[model samples]
Target: MQIQEKIAVVGGGSWATALVKILSENGAEVNWWLRSPEDVAHLQQYAHNPRYLSGVRFDLDYVKPSTDLAETVAKADWVILAVPAAFVQQALTPLAQDAFKGKTLVSAVKGMIPVQNILITDYLGEQYGVPAEHQCVIAGPCHAEEVALEKQSYLTIGSHDIVRAEQFCRLLRNRYVKANPLDDIDGVEYCAVLKNIIALACGIAHGLNYGDNFQAVMVSNAMTEIEDFLHAIMPLPRNLTGSAYLGDLLVTAYSQFSRNRTFGNMIGRGYTVKSAQFEMNMVAEGYYAVQSIYELNKRLQVDMPITTAVYHILYERFSPALEIDILKDKFK
Candidate 1:
């Protein structure tokens, strides 16, 4: 007889709802923490998340929805952080330093901590004392909208402890979802962060009327940029061509569901940063990530033109056309 896995999914977003669906469907008891009390009430009453994925229903017996962060986390052995990167600190602020003392911390977040410029796994280790071996990162070529529709999706679990990563993978694998475990946690996490910036760049190019041919060249060059940045930061022995890295980049850069790309399209189409954000009503992780990565590279001095171009257009208030023109000259 196998023991049931109790998992806590922290966030009220589509990704968090999608994760709760996967785990609960796989027979794990899910303690879902949504910041909105109304959303929690709706999920419990309707067996569906009102805000994000309303179509996918949950089995209430296996999924417990809660508004209390601490209580949600207390009930699970594995806690998956799926909230947007900008809100992560605020969301977990209510917990004590040792609150995650013996649990496995999994980060489904793909952006760096704003101002602090650290990965989610690093923040977990520093703030909550969760050791690296017990921490994991969820990488995609996967999307929440696809998961809700039961479309084929693949996920990569990156962790320092491969065995523990594989254990979590078992909970995620199902009919339409395939989960694989990789040993390079930091490398995978960094690639996830970088891919969003690339996606934004692609969106900017598209909005500027740069056709598929030009975007293809830009994406190819962006891969080289990702390789350079990853080598400088982590210097791990890993394959960048793998689905966790390249596949994820391709999807985010081209997918209609990518908020970062949508956010960038608005910028390229002549919307101000604040205006784009206000209109979308969603957090594009790359908006926060570009600033963090740009500042970090000031010390590391990595040649990240796409990241630099995004930071300039977003933060320095440069014209998207001007920046993209300058950026294209540098790409092969």
Candidate 2:
């Protein structure tokens, strides 16, 4: 736990590559894991990830590449999960064999399973038995491109263990990546998933050429809905108003870097839901989260109006423009 003696960056994705860059810049002896042997060879040889975060070169000397999961886990004092939302449960299942060795489990995933309706955090807990006490959830407005470019960005690290939390913070804090220690692990996790749903809505509005007034109203109502939703599960005081919530929502909804925004924007441009998803290629967390949240509403009965609208647009084949009009009517 002291400065992440040997770190494993799991999954061969843009976020994982960006985090490996962070670790390398911070002088971490990190083993970066790619699912493909070819990717491993490229990173080990050329220091590049062509499949995911292409065009961003890494410092291969500081970081080693491994296609073997067990080999990477064996060398890790901490393992960072960077897989897509749908793959998270499968990713954690193999780790149940004590492969992680009770090391710090840090997740960068922000989506849920559409079929099971499970949060990535809870799924990891159940499958890998990574107790709530040892798990860390990192979420923020940081983009992989920005981190790859070494642009200034910060993210939140919330763990049940304050000591591990602090050490992880110090380990990842760098000139380019700033890690902040926080106490609300659950709030951070839920906010990370839920905010993407709102971002999709914002992008849809923008794609439809709805002016800033419509975007303003939708996001404002969304913030209130998210705060209420997070509060009902447990007690979340002022933390929801911070970066993990509004800051993330604002940027993801407005920024062109967001795949969720792009996904929604295409939907607004009159693309079918499947077409939108097919074009994006990347897993849009909000697309999955909306379905999960809609399923959750059956029991929780919390009014996530924005989420409901997005769900209708994505799943029910409801017209995106009509749904926006409906959300406007309901929230207005």
Give me the candidate number with maximum TM-score.
1
Q: Model 1 — which ten-residue stretch has the worst lDDT? A: 1-10
**What tens-digit string does per-residue lDDT give for candidate 1 at 1-332?**
12389899999898888998888988898899988889988988999988888999999989999989998888889999999999999999999898898999999998998889999998998988899999999999988999999999999999999999999999999999999999999999999999999999999989999899988998999999999998999997778999999999999999999998899898889899899999999889999999999999999998999999999999899888999999878988
User: What stretches of model 2 exceed 4 Å from their correct place?
Assistant: 1-4, 93-96
Q: At residue 149, give the lDDT of candidate 1.
A: 94
Model 1 ranges with Cα > 4 A deviation: 1-3
Q: Give residue 263's error in model 2 in angstroms.
A: 0.2
lDDT scores in order: 0.92, 0.81
Worst 10 residues of 2 by lDDT: 92-101
lDDT of candidate 2 over 74-113, digit per residue (tens): 8888888898887776665555456655788898888876
Clashing residue pairs, backbone N/CA/C < 3 A, model 1: none
lDDT of 1 at 12: 85
